[model samples]
Target: MNSTKCQKCGLTNFATDLECKRCGTSFVQKTRNSGSRPKFSIIAVVMFAGVAAAFYYVFTGVQGSVDKVNSVEANRVNAQPVLPPDAGRSRADYDRYRSQTVANAVGVSPGLAEHANRTQQTDKAMDQMTNSRAQ
Candidate 1:
């Protein structure tokens, strides 16, 4: 029987033995191709593709919502008030007229309309007070 010398411990072993007796070194040459690409299972590939698609869908939906918000803001900025600018009209009168118009359009009861008008007046008074204090 041919004997092979251990590279690590220098102990001689039989050719038929799988490992060095003294050092536990494997004698069999590895047959794996080091240059070959790693294999991915079909399930792994599908999962990766699904994740990519989900991200794409989420990004697109977010972009669409952002576009809608931008469009709505643009419309609000560009919109003209129902009443024309008149020097004779007091700020209170203008607010009352605008609120009445809105109430008429929405078909609200007279009591609710009066409450809305009072709320608008209160808000305007508070805003004026805040501005005066700020100055």
Candidate 2:
């Protein structure tokens, strides 16, 4: 007795069966594979590869820029100011140099400097008055 295996239910049936007894699947029309890649699948694979390559290119470019920016920031953070040979030799010399620099800066706008001095004097007088009243 020759038997045929049902493709859907894996059940053995008689060779004369038109459908599987267990699953009711018809064996009359059978599906065939042609051993070739489908056009849609090939196009999908190509599109996926192109998208992956584009993402890789963008990621590498962004990583390079981030590295460059980090290096520049590290350089800025580690950088020190260049000083003159005679600068900061003694405390008096440093103080004198600092005062001269301040004077030069203030000389650019004398009225602003004068206003700042007046404000300082007024603050001192107010402090003195408060201290006297507290005492």
Candidate 3:
């Protein structure tokens, strides 16, 4: 069975074909019939392409912004000065100290001893608890 058609004269000789011997016609149709189930409409194809392009651009744009933010954060981490370890401090005090250090880097030096005292107070409280529990 000849599985191809001659596009030259509406001859359905074979469809999975290349060209008509009489007339050169591409058998593979790019557009489908309007009445078909999977009908191909110009408007529909354009709309789909447009939506795909929009989403692609939006995702790429947001990804670029995320990359920029991550780079900036990495730079901040690199630029930050590591503080010397202070004795007798809670985690919260250390966080505050880091904040102060960041502020100081930006030209606002907060006294390190202030929070250090608070850490010592916290340490004293913890010591009391430990002693009470031991008793």
- Candidate 2: tens digits of C-alpha lDDT, residues 43-135: 899999999999999999999999999999999878967656884489888889899998888877888699889999999999999999999
Runs in model 3 lying further than 4 Å from the true structure: 1-36, 87-135
Ranking by lDDT: 2, 1, 3
TM-score of each: 0.37, 0.37, 0.39
Kindly report which residue stretches of model 1 are placed more than 4 angstroms away from their true locations once superposed: 1-37, 80-135
Tens-place lDDT digits, model 3, residues 48-67: 99999999999999999999
Q: Score candidate 1 by TM-score against the native.
A: 0.37
Model 2's TM-score against the true structure: 0.37
Model 1 agreement with the true structure over 42-120: per-residue lDDT tens digits? 9999999999999999999999999999999989978956766588989999899999898686566777767878999
Against the hidden true structure, what lDDT does model 3 obtain?
0.76
Q: Name the lDDT value of residue 119 in candidate 1.
A: 96
Per-residue lDDT for 92 in model 1?
98
